[model samples]
Target chain A: MVPISYYLILSGILFACGVIGFLIKRNIITIFMSIELMLNGVNLSFVAFAAQWHHLSGQVFVFFVMVVAAAEASVGLAIIIAVFRTRETLNIDQVNLLKL
Target chain B: MLHLVLFLVFGAICVAGAVNLLAQNHPISSALSLVVVMASLAVEYLLLGAEFVAAVQVIVYAGAVMVLFVFVIMLLNAGAEERTQGSRVALVLGIPGVLAGGLLVAWVLVQRTNTPEVPLGALPGFPKTIGALLFHQFLLPFEVTSILVLIAIMGAVVLASRPEPKMKVPEKES
Candidate 1:
């Protein structure tokens, strides 16, 4: 059996990549994708720990996270569409009308 | 040995896909990379014995969520964003800092001595067990999530739909 640490390490790497992507990416969609990546990373760790502890709760929580992610994606994309309609761009810098 | 190999392979694939997602100029390419990441993560979940979450990952994330992303990209006719001059400090220091932080966390986790040995062949996340838990232990949250999804659907429709044009007032006779 693979050590749980390996899974945790991989999850950490994926999460860091997601954070870097979120920081560097200019497009809102890509930023959102990065967020999803981060969520996936966390889910992986949750499952790993679930396996470690012999509990089903982590997997169940991961399910809930997926559901929330789906809901967030729909609403977020709709908001993105609305922003594009009004602003004519998906660049985060350009969508700063709300910034004072 | 085989399990470790599979984990490494899928983990590598997922990381590469995430990097591609960051590097891609076009949203479509990024979305595709994200799909790859999701698919590979599903495989990882399977390897970890969470068959149900693995299936859910593929179906919801790769299938539905990615489709939504692609549809929005197409609908908006989104083009590649022009590269803006990012701050030099962020470019040079921020990335390494985040990576180091992650490494530190991983190291800390690995250093912990009391991690229990996971038994082989225990399928805690099998669909039957998950379903039972979801309905019996997590019924309220599950039902709430359905409602949340319904609200999201309504919100999307309302937000994306075009507002009707206001009728012009008739001019009074001079």
Candidate 2:
């Protein structure tokens, strides 16, 4: 049987990658992806702990997380597409009008 | 041995996908790499014995949602972003970020862990177990999540429905 440590480590690695990518990536879609990656990372931990505790709460949380992720994806992509039409670019550096 | 090998393989695949996500010039390729990341996550799910959630992860994330990402990438027709020309700013910011991530990893390693050792498929089945818990103890959270999804749906509609840029040359009557 695989230890939960391994799963936790992998999740941690992936989550950190997501955070760094989310911070560093300039493209709007890439940032969207990084956010998804971060959410997925959290979901993994939720499952791991759910398994660890034999409690169903963690699974329940994951279900909610998935619903939220779906909603986030829809809204995020819509915004990106809208921006794309107006600016003809998805680069964060170029989308600076909104930035203070 | 098999588990270790599979772990290493998936780990390599995930790392490669992340690198490609950064290296690829084409938006489609980058999106495809993101798919790889999601798929590997499903595998991790399987390893954890959450077969149902893993399946959902793959179908929803890799299959359905990632398709949306790819479509938008192609539709947007984004090109390679302007090169930073070895901007020192990148290095200055990047080094600290990497260090911060490394510290997180180290912290994870040092932290002692406690787990309840739940057996795989211990719930008798997912629908039953999940149902009882939600209706029994977690009803409020279930309701809140639904609200979250609903709000997100509304937000998506509002964002997508933003006024389209008017064409400089209106369609000519032929």
Candidate 3:
């Protein structure tokens, strides 16, 4: 049986990668995907703790997170479409209509 | 032994996929890389005995969310973003900052090794157990989430629908 620390460390690495991606990626969709990557990393740690503590609540939380992620994805994509329709680009820098 | 090997393999896959996701210029490619990452994480969930989570991770994340991403990319006719000159400030500070944060978390996790080892042969996350808990204990939150999904659907429809021409003249006149 592998130690829980291994899972935690892996989660940390994935999450850091997500953060870096989020920072560097210019495309809004890719940025959103990085957010999902971070969420997945968090989910991994949650399941690890659930196993470590011999409880199921952590997994339940994961379930909720997944649900919310799905909802967010749908709405976010729609907004992205609307933005593209108006601005004609998915580049975050170009979509600066709101910039004062 | 086998568990450790599986973990290493899947963990490597996940990290590699994440890096590829960052490196890819095209959103579709990044989306595919994210699918790889999600699939690997689903395997990790299975390793932790959360079969239902593993299934959901594959179905909802790798499957549905990624498909939605691809669809949006296609609909938008998105091209690879033209790389601008690198931002010196982000390069100078951001990489080290992220790396330091990750290393610090890893170090802290390594220091706290007193967590009880997962019992061998124990099935802690059987679907039945999770289902029972979901319905019996977490029912309200679950129902609320369903409503949230419904609202999201409606919101998406409203946002993405073509704007009526009546609003165009007001904006143009301004």
Top of the candidates by TM-score? 3
* TM (chain A), candidate 1: 0.96
Pitting candidate 1 against candidate 3, the one with the higher TM-score is 3
Fnat for each predicted structure, in order: 0.72, 0.47, 0.79
In model 3, what is the error at residue A83, expressed in angstroms?
0.6
lDDT tens digits by residue: candidate 3, A1-100: 8888888888988898888987888889998998999998899989988887778999999999999999999999999888888887878767767832
Best by DockQ: 3
Clashing pairs in model 1, backbone N/Cα/C closer than 3 A: none
Interface RMSD of each: 1.8, 3.0, 1.7
Taking the tens digit of each residue's C-alpha lDDT, what string does model 1 give over A1-100? 7778777877887898898888888899888988999998999999988888878998999989998999999889888888887887888877867832
TM-score of 1: 0.90
Model 2, B2-67: lDDT tens digits are 666676688678767766777766667778988898898777666656677778888888887889
User: Candidate 2 docking category?
Assistant: medium
**Each prediction's DockQ?**
0.69, 0.51, 0.72
Off by over 4 Å in 3: B86-96, B119-123, B167-174
Runs in model 2 with CA error above 4 Å? B85-95, B111-125, B162-174
